[model samples]
Target: MYLLELYQNNYSKDLVLFETLEEGREFVAQIPGYTLETEDGFDVEYVNPKYLPDYMEIVFNGNIVPLSRFSFNSEENVDIIWKEISNLSVKNDKVIEGYSKIDAYVVNNDEVKAYVEAREANYRKAKDFIERCGYEADRSFFGSEDGEAILYRKCGAEDWHFLCHLDPLFVEIEDVEEYVKEALEEAF
Candidate 1:
């Protein structure tokens, strides 16, 4: 499993770091109001440790409300609660920056028809765009068949990553258009 560290502040930040499953459990237990109310229910909250001994801060209703009084019915509840909190803490760290789509195209004919025209067309267009934008054109084999071609380009000195596959005969033209748009969005 992958763990992401969200906030690392001075006072309680370093002590609250969780990079592994074990660390996550330890961190959850350290929280002042961490507990489970029922056998099946797993509810836990992170509270300032400094305020402990005198008062407990319960996290409920999306607010860190003070717990005037609270009690646990069973030890199993405490275990379940910590387990749930550990899982949530790990999930909160994963951040998705963006996503990219790859467009694929297949040729209509079974016979190998050199994709000279398509390759030249894409290369020309990509080259011109790159040159105009003051960027270098990177070349690479995306995929090739007897008569099909696939190539890609990135702006500037960036990597020339393949964004899609183009099959003139099998793939619909409309899908190819959408794929191109999505690829550009992902690239940027």
Candidate 2:
């Protein structure tokens, strides 16, 4: 199920799960007030990860880290709770960091590998993609034909300034659109 987040004024952030954007939009339409975010603008959208990234950002205790240059045990599936150990060490400019709170179980190895590859592939041409999106990267990530992404805005200047997923559970990429369509009844 895809998560639908709601930012109600003077209240706690709320999240609802849905299988598709249309479904989520429909649900939102019923709410007295709700916000539904969608990703738009891109030259080409990758629906799957085609490359591996040097590092993966996991949110822990409301923070993203285990940043680059850390001992990212490429040793295969080392489960480490990131937030529990982010500031435990520091060695000059090359300080050490650990995984904050990425649950290894939620992460599908195949999906992670694919996402990493795709993100890295886009890295070289990130600027081009930015230009293609009209430089309006209000949201850090966009939902493309490939999958969900992490969009790092050079400067935050748009509505909806970040990707809402990537929670502690950290599930793999999903074809949310397709997932929703399958639930509909046949017209015939």
Candidate 3:
């Protein structure tokens, strides 16, 4: 297999796959502003599927998302969801800021809310565990910045003991199908 990238005005426009170099050349002949270049040792079958990106950006219900603000199921009924998302047009010029509120299609506002709530509850539970075990936990200890890996030591003990990386329980949305206007609204 062959992978051909099409760029317009120095920006990536599209990517097309071909079975042979001849077929790829044929496509290049029909289109303008594209150059065909074959890469040496670029065997399609040699590529590892696991290294490929797991997610895709798609538009649905006038919103481009599966908002990165929250994490959910990777698959999420992709075939059906893609059909819906593909129907909508994507705005190439729109800029997405880091975790900022943007137009989004909410699969389930309730699930998103529940996931956040559950994560918070899990943090509290983790703290409780340390206290019950007579251990003092500090997130800033041992150069740990995020609370995900908590540093704990026996109460009044000099040396810091082990790092507690708790696995928090979270609600996973099964599919991307519904649109909840209030979900994304409340998240922001």
Per-model TM-score, in order, reads: 0.25, 0.21, 0.30
- Compose the digit string of candidate 2's lDDT tens values, residues 1-188: 34443222223223444545455455434322122334475222111112225555534335443333223233322221111122324444532332221221233433555545544444324434443544433223334433343343334445333322333222332443232123121210
For 1-188, candidate 1 gives per-residue lDDT tens digits of 32322221321212222345565555455455454243357433334333344545644334453432223222122222121123444445543322222223433332223443554565556456545545455444454342234445544344555544444442323344444556556777
> Candidate 2: what lDDT?
0.34
* TM-score-best of 2 and 3: 3
- Stretches off by above 4 angstroms in model 3 are 1-111, 140-147, 166-188
Best by TM-score: 3
- The top-ranked prediction according to lDDT is 1
Q: List the residue pairs that clash in candidate 1.
A: 103-164, 103-165, 104-165, 105-165, 105-166, 105-167, 106-167, 113-147
Error of 2 at 155 (Å): 38
Q: Between prediction 2 and prediction 3, which has the larger lDDT? A: 3
Q: Which residue window of length 10 is worst by lDDT in model 3?
A: 78-87
Off by over 4 Å in 1: 1-115, 142-158, 165-182
